[model samples]
Target: MIVLDYPYVSKFLVESVRDLGLPVLDTPQVRELAGGVPLDYIDEIEFSARLALGGKVYTNSENGLEHVLRCRCNEDLARQVDICKDKALFRETVANLHPDYRFLRVSHAGLSGLDLSDFPVPFVIKPARGFFSLGVHVVNDLADWPATLEAIETERAALNAEYPEAVVSGAEFILEQVIDGEEYAIDVYYDAEGNPVITNILHHHFLSAADVSDRLYYTSARIIETWLLPFTEYVRDVGRECGFNNFVTHIEVRVTPEGDILPIEANPLRFAGWCVADITNLAWDFNPYECYFKELRPDWDAILEANKGQAVVMVIGDLPPGTDRESIGSIDYQGFQSMFSNTLELRKIDYKAYPVFAFAFARMDEPELARLKLALAEDFCRFVKMK
Candidate 1:
């Protein structure tokens, strides 16, 4: 039996598990299916009890529910997850592992009364535990500090207003040195024996001159062809240092022009947001959810050998400032696809607030594909208008 919980109990994931002919229960539906379950609200204690009923539990979401199971099943993994969620802990843990492991100097700050006089120029300000790039800003210099705080505060306020239950009240913000390099996300899952398996490596394309808002990401079979050896070793080292095993890890890394790789952060148990891991099925003919639950260790050498010459890209539909879901009508899919001849999938996201996100998958080669990604990010608004 497999128990699914909130944020992870998506139709895509549930159906995928059912396809395996396994008995899966979504936490929320437990009472509906079993009338006497006595689960009034779905929470860590309730979900933890369900997990004790005998089979494996799985969740892609980082919410407390996942951590509850981890705490019960694997204390070390739970620690790793907690550390990853807190950026400061993650930085300190990794940096203490090796002398070469470098992280930018970071200090906690509040929305009001933040001082930047002694801080380095061009630093980054973000919540210690942040998601979807909310409350993230680049402080160019002392002059940009005020605007940066205002932007973060405004975004945080709007988010809290819309989702009061998920408020970030009294959340600690961290200011850190910004790395200069191209960003990339490496998705991997480690087996029970702690061996790392690389699922897919995505090149994160962001708006130039702006440090936030990843506009698009491109993943290709060639990623394994190019960085399989070194990247895997790097991840394995990080995993060992972080003391994580039998877990899903999404590592955000920065690659410099001189070929140095520095980790930005590690997100556990969840691949890219919004079921983006499903894109791997189109790119590699494998299901990530199945791989994790079934403890399948991929034969990367063989998988890469077979799936050469394949590529997939995901474009994010970021809502412009001052725009909400009600204001934006719909995406011009026809016009959008016309720009990329190899478009595989395109869809507009229905979001409640600003910074709305959607994804477009495509098959194309790099260098050329890089240009198309930029064009899509720049011209995304052209395809969306007021309702």
Candidate 2:
């Protein structure tokens, strides 16, 4: 029996699991159309108790849900997840394994008394336990430190106001030396036997040279053709060093101009956020959800053969501050369609605040991609309003 939880069990995942001839016990919030044993009447504790009796429990839920699962179900899984969520802990773990890895931890009280003179310029600052890029800031020099702190303070206030229980609330922050280069994220699952299998690698495109906001991500067959071997080997080494086994992780890394790779962080018990991993279906004709539960490795040779040179970019729409879902009157679908003729999917997220999420996918070249990205941003501003 397979146990699934809230915010993680999607229709696609449920249907895919059923297609594999497996039985599932899903949380109440999941749509009934997915055809699972519904457990909506019971609370998370009861749900967890029921899940513990099952053979394999599957969840993509982060933060609170994850903590509950760790406490009620699996201790090892919890430890691994905790290690990943705490940037300082993650850095220590990696540094212990690899001498070159390093990061600094700052307490909440220390933020006011931080001495920036000793540290190098151009460092990255983020909450020790954070999500959705909340409280993330880049400090280019001592002069920028104050602004960065102010931004973080504002972000923390907004986040705490909106999500009082978020991990970012009242959490210490960590600072790491910024590694300049291209960034990439790879999703992996280590099976029951502790063998790691990589499912997908996405190339992250930022909004600008100075801005670190992830505006777009593209997956292509070229990742496998170029970086599969070395990247996978590196992940395996990290896993071995960290004693991670029977886990699912999303790992981010920076690749220097000379081709040196440095890990940013590891997020455990999930592939990517907001169903981004589903892009594999279009790129590889494979279902990662099924692969994880069934412990199956993708047919890389066939997938690579069929998708050579083909790419799918997922353009994320993060609107500027003060923009809310109600602010947007309606999406001009026709105008949007005309702007990006190659668009495969487009939808605006129903959310409360700034960084309102929307996304579109397309297969196009560099110039077209840039144009489509700009057009999407503009269309969002044009169609949405301050209500």
Pick by lDDT: which candidate is best?
2
Instruction: List model 1 lDDT by residue over 1-387, tens digit each.
Output: 444433323345556755765454445544443334322244555545554553344444545334444437545655766777777677877775445543343433444565556666777767776666766787786877667666765666555553232222226666667778978898888776678887778888776767487667778777768777778988888888788776777899887788877788887666775567767776777887787768775677787777677667877666666665676667676776676768777654555543554566777755577568557556457767678
Q: TM-score of each candidate?
A: 0.83, 0.86
- Residue 376, model 1: lDDT of 58
Question: 1-387 in candidate 2: lDDT tens per residue?
Answer: 344443334455556656775544434444453454332334556656655553344445454344344444766666777788787888888785557644689987799788877777788888887766767788877888778777777776666554334345546889898888989999988876567899999988776656666667888877677888888888887787677877788899989898888888887677876567777775677898778877888888888887767778877666655565565556554554466567766655654543545666677644466665566444356645454
User: In model 1, which regions exceed 4 Å deviation?
Assistant: 1-12, 21-25, 29-57, 64-74, 97-118, 161-170, 377-379
Each model's C-alpha lDDT?
A: 0.65, 0.69
Q: Against the correct fold, how does model 2 do in TM-score? A: 0.86
Candidate 1: 10-residue stretch with minimal lDDT = 161-170
C-alpha lDDT of residue 115 in model 1: 50
